[model samples]
Target: MFRSNSTTDCVQHITTSVELTPIRNYISELNLVHHSKRVFKLKLNFPKFIVICNNNGARLLELQSKVEENWIDLQCRVRGYGIGVWLGLTDLQREGQYVTMSDACRPRYSNWMRGEPNNGNGNEHCAMYWITRSGWNDTVCKGKINFVSTFKDAMIFCNNLGAELLELQSKAEENWVDLQCRIRGYSYGVWLGLSDVRTEGQFVSLSDARKPRGNFRNWAKGEPSNGGNSEHCVIYWTTRIGWNDARCTDKFNVACKKQKEIAYD
Candidate 1:
């Protein structure tokens, strides 16, 4: 979670906050790295910056491999940690106020250090794995140590065939999506990306809130009742051919989704 705040851009985790400013009149280019066990290098214009994204290790192993090597723990682990991404809002103009970048990753899990990201002196804008530590931290960007990055923009989490959490674009898309889930052997039910997780009826896609609710047809004719506000997750009810909100804890199949990779020039 790299964020830019008013004074500095500090990379924090999902829950923590940071401030940043926007640069103007940008130029752009795009390149894709399609290989395994390779450090992804993204060459963006500003100052000729280079970002390396990774995606081969398991959840915890991914973080560990970055910091622990040769049985020697460096000062910080440099993978996927940084306040590099510009939140839509920046503190460059307004100070001390900040909002989180959009949940483009929609992480299913997180490991954060306690009371972390104090942003001491406002220099710690990059996300890093501190030495002798189990969680993560925000630190100054300039350092000799390695850094972490992710290839979220170029990849989508789906089956090899590209089957994923159904995006309900229209009634027809919805109908086709059900078949995709069923073919995948999710007969019991399927977990949808939609949820009232943030608010009751105004359900939003868990991955990117900006995604319009679009045309989710009648909720199984009588579903998504909010269930006393206990149900926050949504799912496609196969039997009903309509949408339903359910307890997030209640196990069910899930739909995979990705947001349009946002790039500014």
Candidate 2:
């Protein structure tokens, strides 16, 4: 039995004419990786098994056969290690291939042949080994491969997707606020961004010049201090009205502006 002290340490096994059925059985006993509810699938079929780290599905298609020659690893500093491993396995399975999934944190190999330790550390958070009917064959698989270079790269990909979703939600909220302001006929002054200073006994607009651009401006009541000529102004939400100095850098719910209709005789 091949045992590893740490999941990151590499284990090399040489099987002696073992059948595929037993190999599959041994792999089943090991732990399976988990991923997010959403997944991206890939289609790459090979008789040999593959080992990958950190569950990077997006870059799966870019994998090349050359990676098989030397041990490949990826290191991503993301919070979700399980999700990353699950995604990589999911992509492999989608390609009609059952993969041996293991983590750099916990690795367990079944009884098999052995050699000198081929341990390594690199961009690979996960590693994949191509398995064949010959039983854990070691021939370089052929394909184009893409590798992750840094933690920032992985973060940028995830963050950009999140930002896009938020932008869409904000647009919808603005539309709702606009409808509310128009129906009120300017009678209800839409306090788009107002706050009260609880300690200073005053209500102030978030747009106060004295306030920094990073304050939380919920306008809770008696905020803004109003220490220096800081009366809240009725700035059009569509124009500069929505922003106050209090919550300059802080993200807040956006309000819409409605113009008063002029009556012509």
Candidate whose lDDT is highest: 1
- For residues 158-194, write the lDDT of model 1, one tens digit per residue: 3322433444667865666566544433334455666
lDDT of 2 by residue, 135-215 (tens): 121111322121211122222333333310111124344454434434322212232333344323343433342332344
Candidate 1: 10-residue stretch with minimal lDDT: 25-34
Roughly what TM-score does model 1 have, to 2 decimal places?
A: 0.35
After superposing candidate 2 on the true structure, give the runs of residues whose Cα lies further than 4 Å from its correct spot. 1-78, 82-108, 111-265
Each candidate: RMSD to true structure? 17.4, 20.6
* TM-score per candidate: 0.35, 0.17
Instruction: Indicate the worst ten consecutive residues by lDDT in candidate 2.
Output: 77-86
| Cα shift from native, residue 160, model 1 (Å) | 14
